[model samples]
Target: MSNPNEVKSTLKPAYDHVIVGGGVAADKAARAIREEAPDASVLIISDVSDGPLYRPGLSKDLWLKADATLEGIDLGTTETGAELLLGTTVTALDPEAHAVTTSDGQQVGYGRLLLATGAAARHIDTPDDDRIVYYRNADDYRHLRSLVSEGIRVAIVGGGYIASEIAAGLAAAGADVSVHFPDSRLLEQMFPDSITSHLAEVYESKGISLNSGFFLSSIHAGRRLTLESRSGEKVEADVVVLGLGAVPNVQLAEEAGLEMEQGGVSVDETLATSAPDVYAAGDIATFSDPILGRRRVEHMANAERSGDAAGRTMAGTRTEYRYTPLFWSDLFDDGYEALGETRTNHRIEEVWNDAHDAAVLYYLDGDVVRGVLMWNTWGAVPKAREVMQASKEGRLKVSELAGQITPGG
Candidate 1:
């Protein structure tokens, strides 16, 4: 699992902290700038020549753990000495000559950079071939785990959360799964229909195939893989996974002008990036969020707490990054845990248990409490972020967040 084309393409013109990306928020911002500037010279460029990855274990435990190992999610880059230029791809971002312009023309330089160019896997116009598998990263989960055998037939498409955890890791490796989606449930903009009708009756009680409202329209990739939809409904398979979600890499922060938002790359609060010495963390960072305010958080706990607060504010320790992270998933046994903006027009509020299999929803908006899931509820994410920081600060009160975290109230 390491040979992403053998990497290490050489580059050392300059670097005190360069970064750009190599996922897991540039390996936790080059191990938090070598633990706060210890001789600091880190580099980490990465366009996936795969050197340090753990991308949510490429959709949960490399397909539901059977002694999972891609060298066990190796995010080591030689334990943070951070050189790694693997497969490069910076392509220009002068940012006032602090420099950066790879893709081979070379022009390194940097004193403090870091963009964490993470995200990109949301296609779906269809027909691309090799039995189409847009499933992001770890080389599409080792090419769909070398095409699982037992009954094969996959056909995923997007029902969110990486196509429901790659249809529970290709139906626990025996394949013959089938998800499709046009939202009739399955994270319909974030659960609730009482947990999306018990998560579509536990993925149709395991045999899978819940084509829900379909609507994909085209994708015929030869030898086996049809998928028509949009009022037609075809769905053959062999392997077709798209999981349409993730777009953030932000074209090198929109060609280096930086400062964008919502669609990400606007920093501040120490993740810096107005340009001076630059910064920006995980999922192209839109950061802010004192309590779910600004956004852009493609999970993995906001890329290791926004790459250790943008590598300790690019190693000088400015570190602020208000951190409102906390994301989790796993579908088969319904593991959950969430935080902030769980959407679906925001007013949620659950708390179930008796066989609905543990819950605690609560999304609210008028009285604050931005979001909190916890389904299959476990240690209660710091008591649901202290009841969403006391409902974002008015001290609870939306009928007291219904049994607050659902203890015995």
Candidate 2:
């Protein structure tokens, strides 16, 4: 990776397409653009010191292998001829002039622009300390790997998937792990109490202390860090891991006067922003979904498909993004893959196996199936998606759908 500050002179004055992110979305978009127009020049500007790699691996594979280096989890080479400007930050956007200014005061013009800026980890009000870590990028993974040892005390703050995965990983690695969250149950927003209970039990069985219905109020670092809850209860730990959610990186879009929707840059079905020749994809784009209406998806599958669509559209192919995104996570011996919205308030119908080890949950908004969650169940995603599509068109009854997917099947 080239140093953006020192290599300012090496940057080109302009490019046919300029992408301002270095995640999966940017990589896919660059590849699509090259496929559509082989002769066009493409450049990718990213703040990450390393080039594009699988972000999800940082939480799963990298954490599981304490000796794993960032190079070991590389997503392989991007065949796109896009010049990557690593360790670089875009400071200003000039839509009218079709150009952007980097932190080093370098003005680079673009015939077409893409903002796949992704997101940043949300933080809490805890005091600064070497033992405190927010799980987000490659650097965080490396730092946490160094801290995990036999009997090492780890307190994870959050009830989301990241927290669950980290707690499971650390616990399996012989660390004394505890999970603290403000919710009454784990994954409260996505799963009902019944499902969350099963998940919590799994963590408890693995020797992970479950601290529910409380959030960290203060952090005092000393020989061992003391974390006080809002209700005055406390727990001491050697290190703290924050799994708070993320906020989309929308400053560039906001400054450029692009329309915003639901905390992201609003784009049409073709993934084109309001500004001429400008597009947004991945977590930063609040795009129009053919089936789910207007929404922004932060998962990896959505980033890949949406970025490809946006790249094709930018290259004058006039493509429309119309795929449903599915996100999956594995923790210990359990995992789930889900598509569509999985809100807890929805009417749910579930089928559990004889051993209660696997289940399929159907979320309904009125008589329409809004989402499907397959717990420890694989090879059912296609069927689930088909069921949802059919339900949306008022073609399938809930009872008929339930009969199709028995617990054993």
| Cα-based lDDT at residue 243, candidate 2 | 89
- lDDT values of the candidates? 0.80, 0.85
- Count of backbone clashes for each model? 0, 0
How do all models score by TM-score? Answer: 0.37, 0.94
* Residue-wise C-alpha lDDT for candidate 1, range 1-409, written one tens digit per residue: 5463254566679888888877777777777778888788888777776776788788888778889888778766666667787777888888888989888788889988888888889775766676687877777777778877789988887888888888888888888888878878877898878778878888888898777788788888777888887787687788888888888888877887878988888888888878898888887788777776788888888888888888987788887988788888878776887888888898887777666668788888787878888877777788888888877778778887667776321
Query: What lDDT score is found at residue 227 in candidate 1?
Result: 82
Which candidate achieves the best lDDT against the true structure? 2
Off by over 4 Å in 2: 1-9, 65-68, 406-409
User: Which pairs of residues clash in candidate 1, taking residues 3 or more apart in a chain or in different chains?
Assistant: none
| Candidate 2, 1-409: lDDT as tens digits | 2322122337789999999988889988988999999998888898877677788888777657767657765554245767888788999989999999998788999999999999988987877897999987776777887888899999999998788888888887799999999989878888877778988888889899998887678989889999998899989999999888888999989988999999999988888899999999999999776667788889999999998999998887999888888999987777888888888889888878889878888999999999989888887888888888899998899888666565535
Q: Which stretch of 10 consecutive residues in model 2 shows the poorest summed lDDT?
A: 1-10
Model 2: residue 375 alpha-carbon error in angstroms: 1.1
